[model samples]
Structure formats: C-alpha cells, structure tokens
Target: MIKNEIKIKSEEGEVFDKKQIALAIRNSTFDDDLRCSLLDDGILDKCQGCNLRYICDGIDQVVDSYVDKTTEVVNNFDFE
Candidate 1:
C-alpha cells in the first residue's frame, strides 16, 4: 500500500518542490523564502487534465473560501 500527505498553504497558491519540502521537514521549519520557490504555480493548474481534478478543485475552493472569510473577519476586528 502507498501513503500520501498533503500540506495546504492556501494563503499562497503555490506548491513547493520536493527539496524545499524535505528541508522544511528536516529543519522543522517553513518560511516565505522556501514557499516562494514553488515547483508549480497552482495545484488546480497541475490537476487540469487529471481524473481527480474535480475533487481537488472542490477541496481547493472550500479551503480558499474559508481562508478568505476568516481573514475578512479578523481584519474587521476593532482593535482600538
């Protein structure tokens, strides 16, 4: 049997390369510099012709929407 792990950085719609990911895991850290060196621009773009595009896109939509709404709420807080 095969296992897979998915890490979603919805704030930035870019996917990291294997090396960057490995380094992050090994160092126990992830930062914007590593994130900027993306292997691919978008997950949906990569999954365009894939059979599981629909499922992946659906999940992306839900996550993106949740993040957007949460950010909006947080931003609107009266911190005065």
Candidate 2:
C-alpha cells in the first residue's frame, strides 16, 4: 500500500483508495443532498434493524469526532 494514500472501506468490505473515491464522487449523478441521504441509507443498511441501532447512531457522533482528529493526523503525518 502507498503511504499517505487516503483509503475508505465500504460496508461490503471493499476498500477504496483516494483516487477511486474521488472518481466515484466526480462521476456521481446525485446531488450533494442526495449523496448525504445515501449516507443515511448506508447507515440503515449497516444497522439492518438491529435493536442497538440507535445506540450505534449515537456512537456515530463520536466516530465523526474521531474522524476529524484522524484527518488532522493524516494531514500532519510524517511517513519517513
């Protein structure tokens, strides 16, 4: 794997590199709001009617904060 390459894993266990993600975003026909809505759909898909879905949703806020911190870390990372 290349150092400094941003990667995201999808719900289906597929990993996408930064360029792939960018390309998908660029090629997407959906508008920004729709895209955001799709994220909600994805969350629902992950939840799949689990009883703890609400708890997981609440934890998502913490995950968002962690992502912010991680983005900062990634921005300032020294691979050497």
Candidate 3:
C-alpha cells in the first residue's frame, strides 16, 4: 500500500489493487450486461458468474458508484 493505492477485495475474498481492477475493466471483451445475483436483496452478493462480476460486483450502478466514490476519495484524500 502507498499514499494512493486502489486496494479492493472481491466478494470471494480475493484481492485486487487499482491497476488490476482497471485492467479488468479496460480489457474485458464480454458483451453481456453486468448483473448482480443479489441485486435488490438488501445485501451484497458474492462475486459469482462472470469475471466482471468478480471484480465489479456485476451491477452497473454499483460499479459506477464505486468508481465515483473512488474518484472522490482520490481527489480529496489527504495523505499524511
């Protein structure tokens, strides 16, 4: 870990840093729309199904929110 690092844990307990996640998103060749197995169930689901889901939680809105939050944190984070 560093002053600015993207460390993330998958629903399956797997870990992914920023670069790994970014690459997975950028290099994905799948055409199916991401979906969360636990969408609207009031609890997060494990990273099941597609590989995208493994790293992205398989929900578009959730992924977007995660990205937005990450950006916000990066922009405002005060590293000491």
Candidate 4:
C-alpha cells in the first residue's frame, strides 16, 4: 500500500482519525466502484451497510464522482 495520509470529515463536521479511516478503507470489502463512491467529495446520499459510513458521509458518492481516478488508483493498488 502507498500509505499516504488522508483526512476525512464526517457530516457532523467531525474529523475522523486518520489511522482508523485507513484501516477501515484497507479492510473494506467494497468493490472499486463502491470504494470510489466512498472517497468522493460529493454528498453520498446512500450508504446503509458500510462500516465507515458514519465518518465517510457517503464516500460512495465521492468515489463515483471520480470514477477514472479511483479506478486508476485502485488498479495500481495505491490505496491497498
């Protein structure tokens, strides 16, 4: 994994712990498409079963919004 640091804020404007978020992302079973959506900056609108949903605030939307980049990063295992 690239192991770069990233910060994500919750809908309540609370910041998620970086290591916690990274662990969640690393262990997530969500597919590339789903993972992408979870990483987007847009409103998620839907995330029922995601463990990180509370802090991610619809990362699925973010991921979906950046389909090309997400796919590339995912394919490269940059976020592994």
Candidate 5:
C-alpha cells in the first residue's frame, strides 16, 4: 500500500494531504504540450497556488518518479 501524505501551511498554519496535492497537479491547466511545462510554469508558483503546496513540494521528486515509472510500465505492457 502506498501512503501519500502532504503538509501545507498558511498564515494560520495548516496541514494538507499529499493525495489532494497530486490531484491538483493532475488537474492543473498548465500547457501539457511542452515537455517541461510543469517546471517551466514554475513548480513553486503552481504549487503555491495549490492548497497542498507545501506538502506537495516535499514529494515532487517522488511523484515525478512514480509518473515516469508508471508511464514506462503502461507502455511496456501495451507493447506486450
């Protein structure tokens, strides 16, 4: 089982769930046509606008890795 976690803080101080952060990332309107859209859009800015930005930043690398791995798995499976 994978445990997704996120912690976001505001002026009042708050914690958020990481899965929610992932959803935000998945739903972001940033142009996906570019290969590095996420990075180009400014990961910090995009995340900062998100409710779970703080927590999401902590797992950015992990999330990217997972996405890459999942894409490879799906592609390989499709080829098979």
Candidate 6:
C-alpha cells in the first residue's frame, strides 16, 4: 500500500475508493469526548465481536494512515 494512504479491500477483492473522505475529514472538527467510530476514522479500540474481526488484518494500518493524513492536512492549515 502507498505511504499515508488508506486502502480497504473487501472480501471479494474490491478496493474501496472515496476521495472526498480526506477533504471531509480535514474540513471537519471532532470532539475529544466523542465516541470512537470504528472503521470510520480509526480503530481506536480492540475488536470485540465484529463480523470479520479475525480475517481482517492490516485494518489498523489503514486507520492509522487515514488519521495521520487527516491530521497532517488539518495541521497545515492556518485559518486566520
């Protein structure tokens, strides 16, 4: 996978592509107290009872990439 890029593949070998996700994430603000939206931004917690918890590996990497990219974009902005 590309560095700092998020690539999620389905069980059928389909890659998920949503470009606007990065822009949306960069433009939005998240509260620290908000619930951790698994597979939305990042897998902040351990998997307890998901449908494909075992088979799905590298998910944490994708989540980290997305979060890192989003944070990078957001930090680079200087809204004055």
List the candidates' TM-scores in order. 0.32, 0.26, 0.23, 0.24, 0.28, 0.24
Judging by lDDT, tell me the better candidate of 1 and 4: 4
Per-residue lDDT tens digits for candidate 1, residues 1-80, read 53243454556785545654444443332232222112265544454477765765665565455446555443555677
Sort by TM-score, best first: what order?
1, 5, 2, 6, 4, 3
Best by TM-score: 1
The number of the candidate with the highest lDDT is 5
User: 25-44 in candidate 6: lDDT tens per residue?
Assistant: 43334432222357566764
Candidate 6 RMSD to the real structure:
10.8
**After superposing candidate 1, which stretches have Cα over 4 Å from the reference?**
1-46, 73-80
Candidate 4 lDDT, 1-80, residue by residue in tens: 55444555678775657675545554453552224455365545556775776656655444445454455543543565
The 10 consecutive residues of candidate 3 with the worst lDDT sum are 26-35
Off by over 4 Å in 6: 1-55, 73-80
Candidate 5 per-residue lDDT, tens place, 1-80, comes to: 65455675678788787666666565342333213445467764443466665655655655566567665433433454
Q: After TM-score superposition, what is the CA distance of residue 31 in candidate 3 from its true location, in Å?
A: 4.5
Put down candidate 3 lDDT per residue, 1-80, tens digits, no spaces: 44333565678774658675555454342443444556557465554554566445443555565566655433565689
lDDT of each: 0.47, 0.51, 0.52, 0.52, 0.55, 0.51
Output candidate 4 Cα RMSD. 12.8
Error of 3 at 38 (Å): 1.5
TM-score of 6: 0.24
| Residues 1-80, model 2: lDDT tens digits | 75434566679775758675444433342342112333466655554667775765655554455446555433565698
Cα displacement (angstroms), candidate 6, residue 16, comes to 10
